[model samples]
Target: MTTSTQPQAQAKRDEHTQPQAQLAVFDMAGTTIDERDEVYRVLRESAEREGARFSDEEFQKWMGTEKHWAIRNLLTIGGVEATDELVDKAFAWFRDELARTYTANPPSPMPRIEESFAALRAAGIRVGLTTGFSRDIADLILESMGWTVGGGEECTIDVSVCGDEIPSGRPAPDMINKVMEITGVDDPAAVISVGDTEVDVESAQAAGAFSVGVLTGHLTKEAFAAKNADAVLELAADVVNLPQVAAQ
Candidate 1:
């Protein structure tokens, strides 16, 4: 009788020791893929082409946000009317330029990113990608990287949620929540969100999930610290080594 009770108690202890995070949602572009900042460059070029002029400092604030919103805000900041028609034109130009740029030189995964995904999945944590890119652009990038989204064994990511699919993008937690819903993760605390911008941290925090900021993108460690990120990693690939992940 004591042996039976001891086994059951040990099982309970093991359950308690397991990681609470069931899913890890990574940001695209600067977070998981090294896109060489072409997105922002094209955005600036498009806005300028549309007769909107803004300084780099002014443009920097819009990074890591939905492209359409960024274009609208940049146009407004540059004293343009930012009418829907104007914004649409600028967004179209930006998208075309980005697609051409990517086609010319496709983006690649950040260092050890694939290995990190495998490690996280092996630990029984589902891996997902949530991005501010529109669904078509995100699909283009993923196709270029030979990544497929699904739960199949060969699928590179367990799920993916794009900006266009959500009502709002980062800093709003819509993308993160979409990923959680897709992955069937009901508890926000059982998720981990990682990205390279302030909005990423803000979104995760808003969703009540663990947020990790990576330095591979636009933000510095200090910037992430100011945002109160749960952890700051030099690279997205280093996520597998976080205590919360490694212990799993």
Candidate 2:
């Protein structure tokens, strides 16, 4: 593989410039996609369907983890041995249910997503999406939104990184790292990542990016700040309009 020149180019760009964000990465479900809490419901349904007795709290504990990982954890918690076959079966069930339900209802942007996209574009920042959903489902949501990245909108998504695309998902830095790589913004300091979960905040923080948490989804106020989010907003779109963004 060829070594990327992004770092060198970024260094040259930064030499005479104040460090500023060049890209923004946002999460999908609960972050920007309004699924109305159906995801967790489906997770629990999948667990139960596979004969695993995962309670709501137990299932929520694994939020933002890869589906297979979450399924194995649920299986183990419910005293079902997590053999490869069993884990695959449970994850498959969850994925199928998610696809079916979402296909029927599709997904809409969370409140303020359009405003956020507008702000990002006005500031000349590129945008990307990182999500725990697999690529197929993420694509499904994107198509439904008519907001497919790099197409279908004036304020387009430059990249979309789904959980299965990387070695691991949130709480790990891989997704954020991948965004930086593909966007040609080598410095995490020049990136802003916003999401509605602790895993989202944690991933950006671990990657050394500015982590913003939004409360438009499953989290409460104190719970958001507890994630050590660099900033907390009522909506993800408010992030690009922050005073710091203007400086960039």
Candidate 3:
């Protein structure tokens, strides 16, 4: 099932004070790399291959979450048993198909994302990337985009936390916490988590960080607002224009 903690978390964030952003953690896939939703398309195909079927709404609810978990949930929704063996088989299929699709039509960086990253770093704010993909797939996408991960001067991102590296994925605070730990950012209030889904907003709130939803992916502005995101932007690259990010 799709998990969320929007109601209680939104109220908590409202009462809490937000500090100026020092570390910006971003989600990959639709938020950073414009992969054209191939991941979701492959996910559906894999599920159907296993005799399971679901609607677009069901598919969307799993967006921004770990692929394995998403597959298991989607299988259950389609009246499948969701056995570990079945889930693993489907997951393997998803990985191979997505990789093949990406190879066929390489993904590109979101518009002006490089400039946005540079601007944030120039303002003394560190940048990070968090993703629901495993390390191998995440590395592939990053390599294709010509981005390097590390704290060195030549690196494009300060840190990268993948789904496999964390204990849990979105709506859980683990990945964001990992980013904070790696970036040496102590206060969650000083971190901004940006992505293109409601789970992204829920995850940020769960981590006590500011959440900025972007329309660069699938969700609409109204959908983001309903999730109680701290702010919403027209594009991922437009994050640099946010008052909190700009002030940093």
Supply the TM-score for candidate 2: 0.87
Model 1, 17-97: lDDT tens digits are: 335678899999899999999987898988888788888778987888889998999999998999999999999988888
| Model 2 pairs in collision | none
lDDT of each: 0.82, 0.76, 0.84
| lDDT tens per residue, model 2, 1-248 | 12221212111112123357788899888888888888878877777777788666677777876677777888889878889998888788788889899989987887778777767766778788998888888888888888856733574678899889987777788888898888788877778888887777777767777778888867787886666666778888777665557665
Which of candidates 2 and 3 is the stronger one according to TM-score? 3
Best lDDT among the predictions, by candidate number? 3
The alpha-carbon lDDT assigned to residue 114 of candidate 3 equals 90
lDDT measured at residue 236 in model 1 versus the true structure, 0 to 100: 87
lDDT ranking from best candidate downward? 3, 1, 2
- Per-residue CA lDDT of model 3 for 1-248, tens digit only, reads 12232313664243134667799999998898899989888888878888888888888898998888888999999879999999999999999889888888989998999989888888889999999898889988988888998777677989999888877888787888888888889888888899998788888888878889999888888898788888888887888877777665
TM-scores of the candidates in the order shown: 0.91, 0.87, 0.93
